[model samples]
Target: MTLSSSAERPSRCADAGKLEVSFEFFPPKSPESEVALWTSISRLLPLCPSFVSVTYGAGGTTRERTHQTVARLVRETDVPPAAHLTCVSATREEIDDVARAYWAEGVRHIVALRGDPPAGIGTHYEPHPGGYAYAADLVAGLKKVADFEISVAAYPEGHPENGSVDTDIEVLKRKVDAGATRAITQFFFDNDIYERYVERVRRAGINVPVVPGIAPVHSFKAIAGFAEKAGASVPSWLAQRFEGLENDAATRQLVAAAVAAEQVLDLVDRGVTDFHFYTMNRADLVYAACHMLGLRPKTDEAA
Candidate 1:
């Protein structure tokens, strides 16, 4: 199926109403952060995302915390939680144990990844001798444990470690072959990059949904640092938007909302429906963007 550059908007079903959306949050590092995260979750829950995900830290550093957070969500909230499992620091047995525990706790979705190294994103990744070799391997292993709904990462620009676009697509295909049900891309600034990448993936014969991951820009410096390590390009135009708003929190928030809303709306206009928001454990900006996209609470009648 050849996708035209102009065919970027997601197809909508009149009977199904607006498009479905999801969110991603990381495990909190402190009590104050925990409070902040729950507050954010509460604010966005009314929008009724398809599911919410919590990120696992590098080298399994946040394994326990991630499990706790995901389990709590299953126990306390109406939202279905997707727990991220990575093949970085643990052996196959250990990784499987985490997946089993999540299943026991009623978590049916898993976001599998070849996580970052202990030293962080820029450092080279070296797989443990007895661990799952890559995310594809981990996905296969998880399938043996349970009939889990799996999602893997996709790179729009390209992965830092991959040789070329073909290699990247091949890796994605392998993940799907290993039982991944969907792919969520790394956060990107330009929608054109995402459109082209998705075209290539479909051309490669991978038929799963490749959901776009949208990161709401909260702090310019913080996001820039992340882009540097994650290999996501920060367009000059984006830099100009935040150029002089360092100390201007009020103005920066306004600009951030506008910039992110423009990106998602462009994606919507292009025919892309499903969005996975990297909420950064904050609600105001992401919530505002979702509202602009026509998302609303699921009232009792609708439910």
Candidate 2:
């Protein structure tokens, strides 16, 4: 039985077991994008994600936008919000003040990262003279500011700059030791790479949840470009699936839903329960994928 990319998802089973999911969104750059972000949130909210996270840009305008979106989540939504924080150009005092302000706003979770250099990815990363230096240092510093639940970045394929997976695991161990509560991976298309990475992580005695990040292919061209820079390999079959559909947006949406659902369902089969979706601030495909996984809009029994 061949499954069409857009075929209806398999029916949910009574004994399908339990699954949990979280979503990640970036700060919108414009009023139109902001509207799109909230619309996405409104759609996913009914599915009751474990917690939603907003991505932080290294500095300047994006940083402030991240704060505003996160603050609004705290004030307007019932779901817990996790704000991304990175150690890059800022001093320790500046980073600490941001953490403190989040605490003041009742935001309790952070995704701490040793961000790319101020020049962006592919450039040499230099720690600021007065900054926390790396992700581990930032994690420790945030812990000092408050007992915030922190998540750190992980890589299925070793990080582009790291020479080996062993070194990557070492960096993760340091972050975990410094009080990271969990690790969310850089998105990858291959589940086997993720499984092997998790095996290596557990072997190193790191026990916190290493959530798999799922990136739906909103645009093959865009995702392919980003994945290339991030060191994740885009499989040949995946490329073939999207090939020649460049001019067809409707077909692309169906293919995207099918691809994401297939990945998540396979993950559930592997006994993994928690998933982190890189929503890219759109809801339709992600929503359909969640529905395929048997998740439904949560109802308030009191209503």
Candidate 3:
């Protein structure tokens, strides 16, 4: 699919009700990046995503920036902010303080995660000495701090450390048992992988909504690197879709939008309603995909 528009793809079902979407953003490290982050947020907010989440960096490195971004969204925009809290290197008390602070700021949703190790991807994860040990523990701790509508990470491709798909579902079950209300999966290119994971989660009796994570391919090379580290398999077909577009930014964006539209439309046909987009702090591809899904910019009155 070289430089095609989503209009070439099948139209969304007439009866497919408006798809619910949430976008993920990482905290910016500098003033210029912060401006870019908000610019992306401003563009996507008008689409009225179900919520927007700010990610915590490995070992809580971006904790403050993530908090500031979420707080600003709560105060300055109509988009619901779901702060990402991780149990990586902080004590239980420290983590609790952050959760309490978010509640104080009128932020109610949280995407709780067992963040990557301090040494970064592929390193062994060691829980903080006195902190919530895992995401399940973090969900329970956040509930103790406040009745947060907690969202936990679900690995459709078993977590690199966990080493098995069955075990991944078991871990997710523990999280749901520990008060997580939803599970947003790590991004996957194969819809069958996601479908099978959801089926297994249901068979295991973990009943919370498992929202599919949809990553619109902003940059094929960038996404491939992320997928490798994050344990998501990038199918050959997916790779072939972006072949030869490395130096072509404009064509890349168009192909990205079309590929993402096809993915979401396939999911919608499969009865999936909610989608969580890993926006990578850029708006165009994700915005275009959502527009293709029949989601429109929120009018002033709606806001």
What is the model-wide C-alpha lDDT for candidate 3? 0.89
- lDDT values of the candidates? 0.90, 0.89, 0.89
lDDT per residue for candidate 1 within 74-131, as digits (tens), equals: 9998889999999998999999999999999999999999998886455788888899
RMSD of 1: 4.5
What's the C-alpha lDDT at position 72 in model 2? 97
Which runs of model 1 end up more than 4 angstroms from their true locations?
Answer: 1-16, 120-122, 299-303
Q: Which ten residues in a row have the lowest lDDT in candidate 3?
A: 8-17
Give the clash total for candidate 2: 0
Q: After superposing candidate 2, which stretches have Cα over 4 Å from the reference?
A: 1-17, 119-122, 301-303
Clashing pairs in 2: none
Please estimate how well model 1 matches the true structure, expressed as its whole-model Cα lDDT: 0.90
List candidate 3 segments past 4 Å from native: 1-11, 15-17, 120-122, 301-303
> Candidate 2: worst 10 consecutive residues by lDDT?
6-15
| Per-prediction TM-score | 0.93, 0.93, 0.93
